[model samples]
Target chain A: MGGYGEVHYTNPTGPGTPPVASLARFVVYLAHSFDDRLALRSELEVEDAKVEGGAAGGEVSLEQAYLDYRLAERLTLRTGLVLPPIGIINETHEPPSFNGVERPGFDHDVIPTTWRELGVGVVGTVPGKVGLAYRVYLVNGIRAEGFSGDQGIRGGRQEGQDASFANPSFTGRLEWAQPGWKVGASFWYGGTADTNSAVGRGAFAAPVTLLSADARYERGPLALRGVVANVSVSDAQAINAAYGQSVGSRIAGGYLEAAYKLLQTLSAFARHERYDTQADVPVGVTRDRSLARRITTLGVTYKPTWNTAFKGDYQLVRNAAGAGEHQVLSLGVGYQF
Target chain B: MQQPAHPAAPPAKVAASIARLFGPGARVDTVSVDTTDVLRVSRADSLLGFAAVGNVLGKDQPITFLVAIDPADRLMDVDILVYREPYGGEVAYEPWRRQFRGKTAADSVRVGKEIRSISGATISVHAVTLGVKRLLAVLTAWHRSGAIR
Candidate 1:
């Protein structure tokens, strides 16, 4: 039932081969400004999508389609298919705008990048009257399945996981910058509800919860950043009899990273990440017996132009059951308008 | 970006100078400037503060001048320097900057109240304008009077 759903939305699995998700879309944008103090801008996108690989693109649906208003010099609000500010990469999700063909492997573990919902946001300069000029933003929460990784480890925030209605949630960031120096801090909090029938003859759900924070500093061509995040769910009322049985315990993870720019368009970076699910930890340090996952990455990013990048890297992965590692090569292309 | 002190300067003298102005915690470190790593002050901590305080300086172009009630007050003076900004720098040069001389701090703060905003760089103009106004107040009352020395 999970893989394949209602027949009305599901087109035949081809002439009987495999089903394909069809997400047709259209978009338009308009922008104008006067005296720079005031500006008008808008965007519209239409979506029609279906799962492609798993059950061969599960169903057809409308994904993201909205309009935005850059009302004042530093404030912008968007509704309709409202974009949710999830992680560092998602808000800045233009393909050509980042390092790898895709975002980092760790970012998705909590806040799925590019996950959008019907909501709104405000982005602009932080007051400006105080001291250093800083920028800040607040956005809505995204759909559950839309917030996590393939296995729901990163951002599996499925509570109130409505594809149609976005729940009340907020994400924000503040940054201070000078000629060659920059520093920033960001936070995220939200609520969700999860439903499943794994334990009962009838379907039921558990509550979805999340909290996270991060900080970073950049000087000249060098940068350093750290993040700590957690996903929580009180399965006490879980329909699944597995309760504390099959389910390990809780969920938490975080990482620290550093990078150096080799050129205006190229950078060398290394990151260390740790995570654990179905277990608990003290001070972000995992205490589970053998369910710990640690990933260390070393890579280089080449940007031939402002909006595009080429990346190559290797990750050293360690699990409590002894340690081993592998190299995965990635190629990706991205852009924004 | 803050200026790097000359390499020939004695390390102790450089440290003393920096501490005089920025206090003791400020330490120089290696950082990528453009594409090469060079030893200088930590860019992460100061750059943003610098950018916030940016409006005063011109880009790549440097101009140094002393400010005092009279030329005889050179020893008790305030030094104003401009660098690295193309569009807004025009406001800091000649015709516009000339308006700054001999005026009190209340003279041109908002720019809108006393002077017209620069055409191309609004934020830069405002920042620089405000910095100049504040610097004048600081120099005339404190630094020139030896409070900083």
Candidate 2:
């Protein structure tokens, strides 16, 4: 048994917005080895730290629950709710592993991280001097009713909650890693119109396609990371018309980060991100410029131990519309065991 | 943590690997000590090197690995014998293990320092680094004390 958690203090530099302190997340991990060939792994999470009967906000959810069966040296079958193998932060987002107090905006708006769905997949590594790893899965599809212009397909994530299987999606990732460098590419293709007759009902109706590439390099005290992703939606106009919503046909974004370890316990980092949820709007719909965003973050992280981090960061948030620009100051402490 | 005992006899694959690494005529003998067991390799009255098996926790389960050292106390090679974790098995890859070659007990043997860190296998990388460092220290002590000479 093990767990991880984080606490945060944030002060957004905007009118009438009060500074807030909160327990951002608390998680517990459980695992059982049934035998030499099979095992079960699970993670239970609490967001906002509490969930009361009448509370307005807070949630308790399962982030991961899967069984792994080792079939060979190069193959393992995984079944149950699983995180799609895409992008850097999706599967390896332990707070101590990242730089800023909060995750990059590109991950939040473009990738919709902490995203999981019911699926079965195979994960393995190819034996060679060139270390190669891969994962592939087929998962339940998203619900188009939750699609929106500002969030794109993020709200559509079923998160394994009675997820509809009428429109299944395929997702996979391939990564090549060596001592000082790692590079990866991933893709997700699936339909979202799950039993919504107005948008037509079929596995291929209102399909969403996503492609992403990411790279990380670390040598000595300097580390660099970058990720880019593009998402395309088919039959967006029909879905928007049927649901009375403004959904985009394409959403795109990326981020670049660099960090340097000034001391064994302290590291400094900076990141720049740009994303547009409404990169391209469907016919008869007006694009919202505010949905296009740029964020620049500068931060420092102190790690007294490998599994604990104290973080502080300043964020300059900008939008194409230029009306709601704001700055944010955040501090946080996080740990994993 | 208590050290796990090495098997009474090295597996055939491991024996073959030892022969392949040290030469066909290399002979290995088990040397039991207070802390752990060591495999002393030699070829006709001349010492070739020493090899020890060590186990370290990776995430939740133990990862068993073998470390070989030359007469000069520098690492000759590292091999993962058994890995039970579902993830972080990348630590067993050749390219990653190769980093330990020629390193001595005096070296840091730290992840992100002398050793390169794997993207998704931080915990295992760290655990193995420390385990190898500890094994190197034990071998160095044995070498100085004439425990196996």
Give the winner by DockQ: 2
Estimate the TM-score for candidate 2. 0.95
If chain B of candidate 1 is superposed on the true chain B, what is its TM-score?
Answer: 0.43
lDDT of 2 by residue, A78-192 (tens): 9999999989999888899899999898888899998899999999987664589999999998878888888888899999888889998999999988887889999999988
- Per candidate, native contacts kept equal 0.00, 0.55
The residue pairs that clash in candidate 2, if any, are: none
Docking class of 1: incorrect
Question: How high is the lDDT of residue A196 in model 1?
Answer: 28
Superposition-based RMSD of candidate 1 using all C-alpha atoms, in angstroms: 17.1
Q: What is the lDDT of candidate 1?
A: 0.42
Q: Where in model 2 is the C-alpha error above 4 Å?
A: B1-13
How much is A118 displaced in model 2, in angstroms?
1.0
Off by over 4 Å in 1: A1-65, A70-74, A128-150, A153-167, A173-188, A194-209, A235-249, A279-291, A323-325, A332-337, B1-149
The estimated TM-scores of all candidates read: 0.49, 0.95
**Per-model C-alpha lDDT, please?**
0.42, 0.88
lDDT of 1 at A102: 34
Could you give the C-alpha RMSD of every candidate to the true structure, in order shown? Answer: 17.1, 2.3
Using Cα atoms, each model's DockQ against the true complex is 0.02, 0.48
